[model samples]
Target: MKTNFLFTMLTGLLLFTACSEKPATTYTINGTIPDNSLDGKMIYIYNRDNNNLNIDSTVVTGTTFTFTGKMDTAAYCRIDASREYYVNFILENGTINLDLSKPVSPSGSPLNDEIARFFAAQDSMSDLIDSKRQEFMKQTEDKEERMKLQKDFFQNEWKPAYLAMLDGFFDRNLNNPIGGMALNYMDGYLSTDQIKAKLSLLSEPVRNTPSMQERLQRFDALEKTAEGKPFTDFTIETEDGNKVSLSDYVGKGKYTLVDFWASWCGPCRAETPVLAEVYNQYKNKGLEVLGVAVWDSPENTKKAIEELKITWPQILNAGEKPTKLYGINGIPHIILFGPDGTIIARDLRGDGLKAKVKEVIETK
Candidate 1:
């Protein structure tokens, strides 16, 4: 009778353990699009926190589509039918119901619900401003008048409301995937210092994301060479196999205009004539224009110089060395350095370049 009791106790313990075991975590995404235009479109899911990697895709049949998968951790993901129509949501281990017809309407997950509301508020602001712009465009045939109306609306209404929404969203969601996504959006609108300030407010889990790490590195590079900071010098090998350093021209005596460009870049080529014009106007005074050819071969650089009539001194075959040092992601990044090598202005383009050179030189 005692042996039977022991057996019964062991069986009871096994049953309890089996009941307490946790189930495998997974996610289900049930999406519907009422837009007939997107009935046969292919929908894609990208892991935004993971360098925008395309992790899953499916074709829409009729009015609905579904995606199911498991992830060890929740990530910020985006669903796109096309570039113009996309929605961002937290991909957690739960069922998510999404309506792709609207800007943001994901539901059924805690984080996704919050993200949806946040983006909905943002869409309202965008829609209102768009409506105002459309009305003004209809009223005015003059380009300048239309531009003025849009600019005034942006400064008075749109920017302040947008910033407030962004601030509130970041504050409320700093510890979640929503905060990570917000930081990515802030990249274009905020300065490096501003982004760093926001970064400090984020929780460790959010800050540790891949996109955040890349932003941190970019901010570091930008800060090291920001305006009013002294120039960071780099050496380049010329076409004649001679070495030239940026220190050779900058910080000597005259104000220097540095152009970081590539031979294959259309905008870079387009801006060369403007640079030449600026050089002619200011070289006799206290200005020097130096061209640093990046991400191009010596042959192409030389051919471009001859074809474009670029008379300025050039450092060829610089590759990506200079671009990395200055945090330059795109070519044709122009910088104006003070007489003492401090960066006076950056990203100068078109008539603004000429005006800035004029202002500084005339002041000198």
Candidate 2:
């Protein structure tokens, strides 16, 4: 995005004298369509939030098109030329200059600039994997050979490099809106400690933002159960009004697998059969599987278990205590506990659960 001629002149004069600190207060997007291919295309600026489409649009009249609007806050906007592909830009109150035939990086909005940097980082990440995959493909005609090459590259190299890049980016940009935006993207990629450490590095202004604060709270919840930490204890009521504590189920002289799930959760439901198989195979092998149903009624929990034929011991109507204790924000938060009651691993599912159970219980 490019600043208006008047605004740019005023900004330059202000910066020259170091006298004014006012900001640009409107948004302008200038586009160069460049060919008859898109001359009749109806371009749209889509706002992802509120499920809004074409909050603004322009029909290409010739080789160029432009859009101008007022905005109180900066957000990500998609320039949709067609369904298959689109360009993303930060919608800020400033002029954004673009040549559709060239790169989509816009200049005026600082938020947009930061967003562009983050995206470039992402593209670089993808490019590295693509390069490795292509190199492997060129050397091998076997389908399985190419598959292993791609898998090895991603699992061994992509994650560590991408995580290190993210760590540096998050560390460097923790004082602003960009830092706030980056937190949501850290899920599943950063470890519990990495998330906590990086989040703490964020400046107060960014950390104080409501969303950031909420994310911090969530990180707080999960970090308490970090792998290798002792599992916190909690109790739940059974259908017969008996209070069954976690100590009764876990922390025994066996590896305990706590399956935090809900009856309505589809993924959790799908994982029941896997749980059943693992439980059947390992129940007597110093491995115990415990089900804790949360956010679902005792009736439904019982019904689902019966229908699914899950014979494992379950704590119904477990509610939020287990989640809060475990710092779990999502369902199917499986935690593997050592016999001494320390948390061994978390978020494992399906084959991961079975493999981990075998690795720990059988291999020992």
- TM-score of predicted model 2? 0.59
lDDT of each: 0.81, 0.73
Residue 50, candidate 1: how far off, in angstroms? 3.0
Tell how far residue 127 is off in model 2, in angstroms: 7.7
Which predicted model would earn the best TM-score?
A: 1
Candidate 1 clash pair list: none
Clashes of 2: 7
TM-score of 1: 0.70
Report the C-alpha displacement of residue 13, candidate 1, in angstroms. 51
Model 2, span 7-75: residue lDDT tens: 332222122112154678888887775575677678888764324455788877677788888876555
Q: For model 1, how does the per-residue alpha-carbon lDDT over 1-364 read when each residue is reduced to its tens digit?
A: 1323323433321221112334438888888876656777788888888888987888888878888888776788888786556677788877888887665778877777777766666666667678888899899999999999888877765665566566667777788788766666666677777888999999887888887777687778888999999999998766567789999999998999999998899999999989999999989999999999999998999999999989999988889888888888887999999999999999999999999999999987
